[model samples]
Target chain A: MWFDILPSFWEGAKITIQLTLFSAVIAFFLAFLAGFGRLSKIKAVRFLAATYVEIFRGTSLFVQLFWIYFALPLFGIMLPKMLAGVLALSLNAGAYGSEIVRSTIISVPKGQTEAAIALNMTPWQRTWLVILPQALVMMLPAFGNLIIEMLKGTALVSLVTLADLTFVATVLNSSIMRPTEIFSVLLVIYFVISLPFTRGIRWIEHRLSAGRY
Target chain B: MSVPLKVIYNEESTKSIGNDLRKVAVQPIVNYSNISKSYGDLQVLRNIDLDIAPGEKVALIGPSGSGKTTLARLLMTLEEPTSGTIEVDGEMLWHQKTNGKLVKANEKHLHKVRGNIGMVFQHFNLFPHMTILRNVMEAPRNVLGLSKEEAMERAVTMLKQVGLANKIDAYPAQLSGGQKQRVAIARALVMRPKVMIFDEPTSALDPELVGEVLEVIKAIAAEGEMAMLLITHEMDFARDVADRILFFDQGRIIEQGSPKRIFNNPESERLQTFLSRFNRH
Candidate 1:
């Protein structure tokens, strides 16, 4: 019976993995864009970035997923279900991640920027070459936590009738009447999928922090 | 194998004449005119006028909060003066000329002018994440657009000059305070700026470590190719390295003269009293 359900679980796991990765890519770019925007010298840019961060972070991700999936169509802008799920997850996660980026960038000592300026570096060069390299090392652990949160957040997508792991498990449990065995298997699968992400972040953190430690 | 004596003599005479003409045409490498800065109501710098000639070594000595570091910071564009203009290599630093009028300089103007200046901070702000060689090579490679090979060559030579060639691969945290400061000096020196500003360069080091850092600075000053503005509390080091010294107190330069006159003559009561504190040791 375990072997029979394993194949179904793998199919569902694939969808969950895909959703996590797609959303993570979008979230990563948004994290940097909003992060740097919040610190931008232009007032309008700062305002826009702050608004995005606050709106997403201050509200519930569950409602955001619903709004994107169910509410966006009211304005005649219909996104496919997968894109909607990915969009909501990324936007929500990116908001929280931008704060991580902003705070870590801020925590990089002021002297680093001054030193870069003293070298006659342009603002872009200062940010990319000097500031970000240092900020990145500090940002990884927080970002690691965020990635895991995002991975877990993918379980929410099953509610939108997506055939992700949790949705498959629920369907299987109802049909087979084996809630105890199937749910335990479902729990193990999620934990197994999350392990590599945590390990990968640690490996990257170790590599980036090679000399400092 | 010898050249004609008369030919050598004529060449020397013409070279001397050229030197005289060049001196008249050359503007001060760094100039500050009527500069002042304030944080809210508390003013840190008052109306001040100063000039640093090419290859000149000027030391600023004063009490804490006397605004010596502020002078260097203003020149480096780290802090904007509340009023007045600075010029670097004959170009306006804080203001640019537009349509025969002086307008506050933009980022492009400041970047161009600032390329002529380099600063070493008291904290030796080497990028902690970079290896020593990368820290020194980064600006020249990215900012100056030097090729990797060229930047690497320059970085190696500079590290060697500072006696840290063996530690090129080391991170800043792995080095002593003095070693880190030496890497910082090499990082600045790699830029080959017309003016180098040292803001209490050795102040953050251990007592025994100070000598190594000062030795690197002394060697650089001895090259006599770059103008140096050193703000330091090391009285003896200032006296040794400075061609001229300015005594700053309460945001103003109370006295300025050769190191000998500034140290020995003791004209101002404030300067006299200031020197006495160091003299006590």
Candidate 2:
């Protein structure tokens, strides 16, 4: 049964990898801006970042995907279904990643900031030269985990008829008249996609924190 | 390649201000005219006017609520005055120099003016993520544009003075409280400001460590070439190093005079009782 389904699962995995990788890159870049915006002193900047994070995080990602893929067309806005699905994933994942980014930045010792200021570094210089590099190093593990979650989240896009891994799985199951075997194979494929990313982050965290402990 | 911790500071005197700057050589190094600060409704300081001659040692001695820390913070521009001006080396700082004259200083002006002064906090505010050598050399290489070799040489000499010359590469967490405070002094001093202000530098150290930090401070004062403002809880440290003591009470300078007079014969009854409680040998 496993051997029979391997070829079909392999086909499904290709689209899953593309959706996850494309969304992850977009989400990672947007999260940096959103996270730093939340830390901005200007009220408007801070409010905008907070509003974006809250609007995205408070709602379900699946609902968000549906709105982009299914609901936007009624408002006279037209977008490709595949494009809409990736946008929703990136936006939603960015909201969650921004919080992780913020907490990681704040966790750095305040003394480092004081030291930077004492050295007469401009605010921008301090952010990039002193703060952001350290913050990026700290964010990687959490971000890596988020990427894996986002990969799993791409399964919801199957409902939009994107022909992603989940959609292909459902089609194969119906055609072959075997729900349990097809579903189990689908689950294993998702696991195969996620587990290595999870382990990679763990290995990174261990290597970075190795001798510090 | 490094040594133990020593006296670190924000003012790296050796760079621009140097050890032998005369008050009148260029102009006044420090002038705080009618500076005031308030946190919400609680006014920490009001109507403070002060001037420090070059290389003079002024110690601020007061009870806990007497605005000692606030004064130090104000001078460092860590907290700006609600109303008034702060000038450094006779240039219009903490305020804009308008029409070839002085106007009320704002944040931008303070940024430039404050670049010339350095401060050391009581809690040692050392960068925990950085090693002691990096902490010592940061401002010099970054702000002062010192070559790595130059900053390292200064860092070593400063550490040697503070007696922590052996722990130069150690992290703050690895050092004792006294060691951390000394590294903080080196970090501040690396900038070579005209004046150095230490706010309760020894208060947080273990008793044994306090004396070591004080010894470094006393050596700084005795050098008699760098204007220093010290805020300390140690009566002996204050008396030993301070040329003059500004005894503050209730947000006011109750009295200011030579340490011998203030510590021995006080003009105010408030000072007498306050000093008496801790006046033990």
Indicate which candidate wins on lDDT: 1
lDDT of 2 by residue, A55-77 (tens): 99999999998888778889998
- Candidate 2: list runs displaced more than 4 Å: A74-77, A107-110, A200-213, B1-27, B98-108
The residue-level lDDT of candidate 2 at B49 comes to: 80
The CA root-mean-square deviation of candidate 1, after full C-alpha superposition on the true structure, stands at: 6.3
lDDT of 1 at B183: 93
State the DockQ of every prediction: 0.66, 0.40
Off by over 4 Å in 1: A1-4, A202-210, B1-26
- Candidate 2, B95: how far from true, in Å? 1.0
* Candidate 1 residue pairs that clash: none
Leading candidate by TM-score: 1
DockQ of 1: 0.66
Per-prediction TM-score, please? 0.92, 0.87
lDDT of 1 at B279: 95
RMSD for all candidates, in order, please: 6.3, 6.8
Q: What would the per-residue lDDT of candidate 1 be over residues B1-281, giving only the tens digit for each residue? A: 12111111111112112323322334577778899999999998999998776787889999989999999999999999999988787678998879978899999999998999999999999998889999999999998999999999999999999999999998899999999999999999999999999999999989999998898999898888889999999989998888778999999999987777888897999999999999999
- Fraction of native Cα contacts reproduced by each candidate: 0.85, 0.32
